[model samples]
Target: MTAYIALAVVVVIVIWAVAIYNRLRTYKNQVENAFAQIDVQLKRRHDLIPNLVEVARGYMQHEAQTLEAVIRARSTAVSAADEARQSPGQAQAMGALMVAEQALVGQMGRLMALAEAYPTLKADARMQQLSEEITSTENRIGFARQAYNDQVLDFNNEASQFPDLIVARLAGFAHMEMLQSTQNEQERAIPQVKF
Candidate 1:
């Protein structure tokens, strides 16, 4: 009787541990999958940038500095993204990548504003298509990033809770940091013109 009772308790503990481990694994994979979605959108955005720059170069001869800034920002962002890809779970790399992405967005905004001053550029069919594509890519990236952060939050909550935290530590499951945007709400808001 005693042996049977001990065996049942051990089996229950083993099953419980396995369940916790599997849950942690699912959350980790979810975070990675979310990041992959973001990566695809970012790649599409990066590819469109050079084409936009090339199209703008012809019409915006006097705006060399703005064009150069956009190019530099794009290059930095691409490099940071590559680093983040190599270590998707590393907090520092993810944080740096987010900062680079925001900087790239800001530079792209500047380039677009400059484009508004060029009537011929705005009228170009190719430029319009590329601009539309970039805007679509940006929206997808935003959605993907939100999903990634949500997954990170879920994983973090699991890892921080008492019994699960014990299991997480035993299973070597480190808490994941959410991929945060460098932009604030005010920065993202459009300025209203009363005039």
Candidate 2:
């Protein structure tokens, strides 16, 4: 009787561990899939930028510095994105990507604002089309980013939970960093209106 009781206990423990391991694996996969969605949208944005710059170059010839800044920012963003793709959940890689992307956004904003000063550039059909495409891609990226953050939150919660934390540590599942908004407090703050 004592032998039978010991065998049953061992079997139960094995099954419990296996269950926890499977759950953690599933969450990790979901987080990766979420990041992949974001990557797709980012690629679209990156591809559109060069075309936009080319179209704007004709009318904004004197704005060489602005155009070059945009291109350089794009290159940095692409490299950062590649690093993040290799290790989606790693803190350092994600932080680098966010910083790179923020710089790209700032550069792009400057390009567009300069374009606004050039009526001919704004009126060009190619520039308008490229701008629209970039705007659409930006919206898609926002949605994908939100989804990625949600998945990260779910995975972090599961990995850090009581019983699961033990399995997570044993299985070497580290906590993931979520992609936060690149905006600073000033950007997020509401503006005051005067009548």
Candidate 3:
């Protein structure tokens, strides 16, 4: 009777171990997929920048410095994008992308502010088309980032939970990074122009 009881205990332990391990595997995969989606959107955004720069260059002939800054920001973003694609697990890569993104936001703000000086630039057909496409891409990036963060939360929760965390730890499950919520991403009321 004692032998039978020991065998039953071993069987139950094996089943529990396998179940938790499988769940951890699934959670890790989910996090990767989520990151991949964000990566794809960011790449699309990067591809659109050169076209935008080209269009903006024609009108901002005297603003060579501003154009160079935009180019540098775009280059940083592309580098970050490549790193993210090659190694999704590296948090530093994500940080680089955030830096790149913040730089981009600043450059974009500068360009738009400069646009105020050149109304004809905004009126150009190529510039208008690029602006519309970039705006759409920006919307997609925002949505994708939100979705990636949401999935990261879910995966991290599962990875940290009681039995799962044990399995996660054994299987090398690491915590995923949260999306950066910088001041640039926040909204402020535009100052009123009571002319």
Residue lDDT tens for model 3, 1-195: 999999999999889888988877776677678778877877777788788888888899999899889889988888887887775646887788788887886887788789769989989988888788878877877888887788778888888998888878887878777667422734445666996
For candidate 3, which ten residues in a row score worst on lDDT?
Answer: 181-190
**Per-residue lDDT of model 1, residues 25-84, tens digit only:** 999898888888888998999999999999999999999999999999999999998998
lDDT: the better of candidates 1 and 3: 1
Task: Give the Cα lDDT of each candidate.
Answer: 0.89, 0.93, 0.79
In terms of lDDT, which candidate is stronger, 1 or 2? 2
TM-score of each: 0.89, 0.96, 0.87
> In what order do the candidates fall by TM-score, top score first?
2, 1, 3
Clash count for each candidate, listed in order shown? 0, 0, 0
Pull out the clashing pairs in model 2.
none
* Residue 96, candidate 2: alpha-carbon lDDT: 98
Error of 1 at 104 (Å): 0.4
Model 3 C-alpha lDDT versus the unseen true structure: 0.79
State which candidate has the highest lDDT: 2
Error (Å) of candidate 2 at residue 117 is 0.6
